[model samples]
Target chain A: GESVGLHLPTLSVQEGDNSIINCAYSNSASDYFIWYKQESGKGPQFIIDIRSNMDKRQGQRVTVLLNKTVKHLSLQIAATQPGDSAVYFCAENAGSYIPTFGRGTSLIVHP
Target chain B: EAGVAQSPRYKIIEKRQSVAFWCNPISGHATLYWYQQILGQGPKLLIQFQNNGVVDDSQLPKDRFSAERLKGVDSTLKIQPAKLEDSAVYLCASSLVASGNGGEQFFGPGTRLTVL
Candidate 1:
């Protein structure tokens, strides 16, 4: 079965520094991708999404970069804040009605 | 507008017992989904519904789990003879079918189940 995976399980960054999380997907047919942020004991919240047609999409202080050539995706957070720390997940939809998710990356911001 | 809603913030049940979780999607949304998230993992789609009909349920454990969206409004998921491994957070989400070719999902607070 095809799978989506993250390069790291945990990340630590300074409160004011930029944060980058990486993900790799196995299915080439995946045309849509989404990034979700989940706080402790809460459901996932939509962050940003990118279609296969575009390479990048920016929203607020977050940017999603998609490299279809390598089946890689990344989420970049500018000026990281305490509230930005959470578990991030990357999901891929490959013509299927449902989306598959990655293991998840735990982001920790140091004050 | 209200987001997706789920009941029983937390549940503790013993093995072989039955449990049911409820969900209410955003008003007027045509697409609904149920996902299971284990600790340290992302959400996994269990079932999908379009209106009152089931769109996909390939990942659902049909032997022990069943779901229905009555009147295409609210939905419920029931797990009969639950096992210890069934413990996880159940999340319900909805998306507007008219938003885009690939709609974005809005999630609920989730129901955390702990099987003892």
Candidate 2:
């Protein structure tokens, strides 16, 4: 079955340090990938996205990298802050308009 | 511009009871979606609507769940005789259309349902 999954259930980082969250998808035909951040008591908010044709994309203090050969994806946060603590989710869109989401990775940033 | 709007930020009901959730999408959006998110999991799509018609409901539990989008703007999801496993957050999202980069969706705060 088609599925998207994360390599870790939780990630912890000190304030001002960098953080990385990883994801993997089973479908190779997936054309688009998105990363979302969900704060406590809030809905998931869009972070960044990368298309299959592109290996990397950056936004603000975050970057998304895609490795099509390994079917892996990663999100990097620079200078992590306490406000960055949230559950992060990765989604894959296989031209279906509806993206499949993976179990989220809880990111805890300590000050 | 306003984002998606959902009513009754939280709901608690007994098992076998019925509950309904309401959603109002962003203005001018043509695509709407409903998703269920468990405590420790990502949001899962339950159904999708393109304008006023249904696009996908394969993951929806038809035996207990029903949804409708009237006039292609607002939507309502109803679950009758709910089960304990049905306790989850119901999220509503909408986009301009179902394809292309413009299809990026904006989500609402969601309604948290708890079945006792």
Candidate 3:
């Protein structure tokens, strides 16, 4: 399942499928971007991050792609699992060290 | 390293009541942040502190919301005469420093506030 809009509230996908969650950032001067996953009853946790100078960063089972031209950031999960179900949010630091978070996208993986 | 820690994992209060939340950032971390997360929404920055100094608090509602990080270690957030709209999860996060790199912030479990 894929959600590319700025306000992607939900994404439903089957287990073992790939998932793509997108975020549209508004800061043109942001040099740092991060992706976070928040589970129920817990705070948001860091997923992956990329500097403006970089285009993509990969982590275990996760990949983050950043496009400066369009100010778009996307997180790709290789194999969606039940444990991966959560609300995903993107944060951008516009040189202030204070990140502005985007609206969250809740991903629901079905077994 | 230990993650940020917050007190009162859950809170229940009525309108016009007062409440306070506490936070302890990871050891050695100099930057602390407080965020408010409403249901189905992303967390919003409420205030930021750098070693006991207020860095950014533009988003904080100074009228009723106040926070302080004393001695550059633990912090506290208080709400006077809480309103129903104030119901949300209050999260505390910490990072190494306030820099251009924007180091990943480690978050606490967050205090869920419900105002009646």
TM-score of 1: 0.97
Q: Give the TM-score of chain A in candidate 3.
A: 0.93
Candidate 1 stretches with Cα past 4 Å from truth are B98-100
Worst 10 residues of 2 chain B by lDDT: B97-106
Candidate 2, CAPRI quality class derived from DockQ? medium
Best by lDDT: 2
* Higher-DockQ candidate of 1 and 2: 2
lDDT of each: 0.92, 0.93, 0.89
Docking level of model 3: medium
Kindly list the per-residue Cα lDDT of model 2 for residues B1-116, writing each as its tens digit. Answer: 99999988999999999999999999999999999999999999999999999988999999999999989999999999899999999999998977335478888999999999
- Model 3 achieves a DockQ score of 0.68
Model 1, position B62, has a per-residue lDDT of: 98
Q: What is the two-chain DockQ of model 1?
A: 0.62
lDDT of 3 by residue, A1-111 (tens): 222235578999999999999898766888888889999999999998899999999999999999989879899999999999999998888877778787788999999
User: Any runs in candidate 2 off by more than 4 Å, and if so which?
Assistant: B99-102
Error of 3 at B94 (Å): 0.7
lDDT (C-alpha) at residue B61 in model 2: 98
Per-candidate DockQ values are: 0.62, 0.65, 0.68
Which should have the higher lDDT, number 1 or number 3? 1
TM-score per candidate, in order? 0.97, 0.97, 0.94
Instruction: Please write out the lDDT profile of model 1 over residues A1-111, one tens digit for every residue.
Output: 789999999999999999999999999999989999999988889899999999999999999999999999999999999999999999988776568899999999999
